[model samples]
Target: MIEFATHRNKDPRLSFRVLDMTVKNEENLKRVFTDTELNPGFDKVFSFACLMWTSDHEQCLENIFKLLRSGGQTLVWFMGYNDLSIVYKEILEMKKWMAYLKDEPILKYAYHDSMDVKSDCYNLMKKIGFQDIISDCERKHFKDYVDIYDFKVHECMDPYVNKLPQHLQREYLDDVITVIDRHIKNDGLTFDLIILLASKP
Candidate 1:
């Protein structure tokens, strides 16, 4: 995404900095920073399909707010709901998998089990001092079926699979794939996307 943004940027006025939020620092870039460190601050922040991977939604949102200049806005999009969440929850209940995944907080998506996601997010942003907040959850159905290989790679289930011995990795994956297969509907996957638009006041 950073590469694409860099290639497409034509304006000399715009500059970009990167932070790998999963780590404290990648070489010299920080995983977290303050607006004061940016001199004044950034005019906007955009998080796309990234926050779903974060375990701390509140702190992440707060960080985004702190990154922006006053009146600067932000747009964040993430997976609010997915069938794989259900699959993971079910798999976690299995005795064999439980031993490996017991300490894992596998549901990284914010409010994945919320009865009222929008309201919950709105309240969070409002409490964070953001103005003109808009939080919505929309369900989308993709045309193509989920490929097993792609699912294994993109779903980030390695943390669970890697805990077992190398010889048992394939067996564990097969078990997970079985659970995933049961959730596939009409040869496609449906996702609930959470879209948030807010401004730092």
Candidate 2:
């Protein structure tokens, strides 16, 4: 990544660092790039099934552009919000509750914004000067992708649940579990996963 960045800047003196953590603090970001040409920092970058949870997805995409070497590629796989096909009534109700929780200020950051830039990831990449953009959507039954869904919910949803009011936390957890169980039993859950590939120009 550093090599790619330096090459783009045409400066051998440039350097880069990859922090395996969320880039949320501008001060920390500034500190990390001191005395270096950090633009166009990578040859290839990838995010797997993770972009949907970000609050400022536009900013994130912009940063990714800044960090990519010219002609560098980016690959991202994320969930599509409107593509979930749920037939079970109980699961539908649970989905409503989940939506309500997502609106809460305390949990908003962890929630996925279905209509954010992520919804049109390919277009966003093109708008950001990316070329050769390719996007594909894959739909699958929840039972077939249960492992992935389980991991995502645990990683993204559990944290929010943990932060809820103590009195409500257990109840929420129970309800969510019940919904999952019912959906699995009835084969009522389905998901749409979108994959995007683009190259910075």
Candidate 3:
């Protein structure tokens, strides 16, 4: 994602740095910044699909706070729970596959639970001393069946599909693709995407 962004913006003033380390390590985080004070040295921090992997969401927010200059902002985007009316049929189809792959650990890791902190994002930012906190939930409705089918397969199934037996991987992927294709044609899927924008005080 960063690579794509940097490639599109070639101006030297627009610098992009990719850190290969986790935010849990404060020491490693400090190495990325020149300043050692409470406020490190960035005007803005953007987190996309990263918080879900972090073990400590609040700590991660704190670390980001430490890196931002006073009044700097952080923008976060993450997935939230699906709208039952729109996703119920799709969920039923997914459950069938999940039951068949119940023994797979990756399946459990990928689908059994959500790592997203969608419900707590606003409160977490407030607790971390962010001001002017604003959060919005947008329901995305896909007009094209292929678009949503592709999204579900890639975002929700790919991780688990990679862990299937070599011979079964293709079969599993094909099965999911078929299921999504069928279900989506009947009723287009809708899901909520949450965005949080907050400023460090």
lDDT of each: 0.74, 0.58, 0.61
Candidate 1 Cα misplacement greater than 4 A, ranges: 1-37, 93-100, 106-108, 147-175, 185-187
Which lDDT tens digits does candidate 1 get at residues 1-201?
466777899578665566655443322223344435554667988998778767777777877776788889999998877767777778778888787788877664567678998999999999988999999998887645456456556335333676677887888877777776777745577778999999988
Candidate with best TM-score: 1
TM-score, cand. 2:
0.59
Better of 1 and 2 by TM-score: 1
lDDT winner, 2 or 3: 3
Instruction: Note the residue pairs that clash in candidate 3.
Output: none
lDDT of 3 by residue, 1-201 (tens): 578889999997786776543456777665765454435567888988555333456777787777778888889775554433233234335654566556543312111134544446677788889889986666677656456444554544244555456776666666656666666655665555778898877
Candidate 1 clashing pairs, residues 3+ apart or interchain: none
Show model 3 residue runs off by greater than 4 Å.
1-9, 20-22, 36-40, 49-56, 83-119, 148-176, 182-185
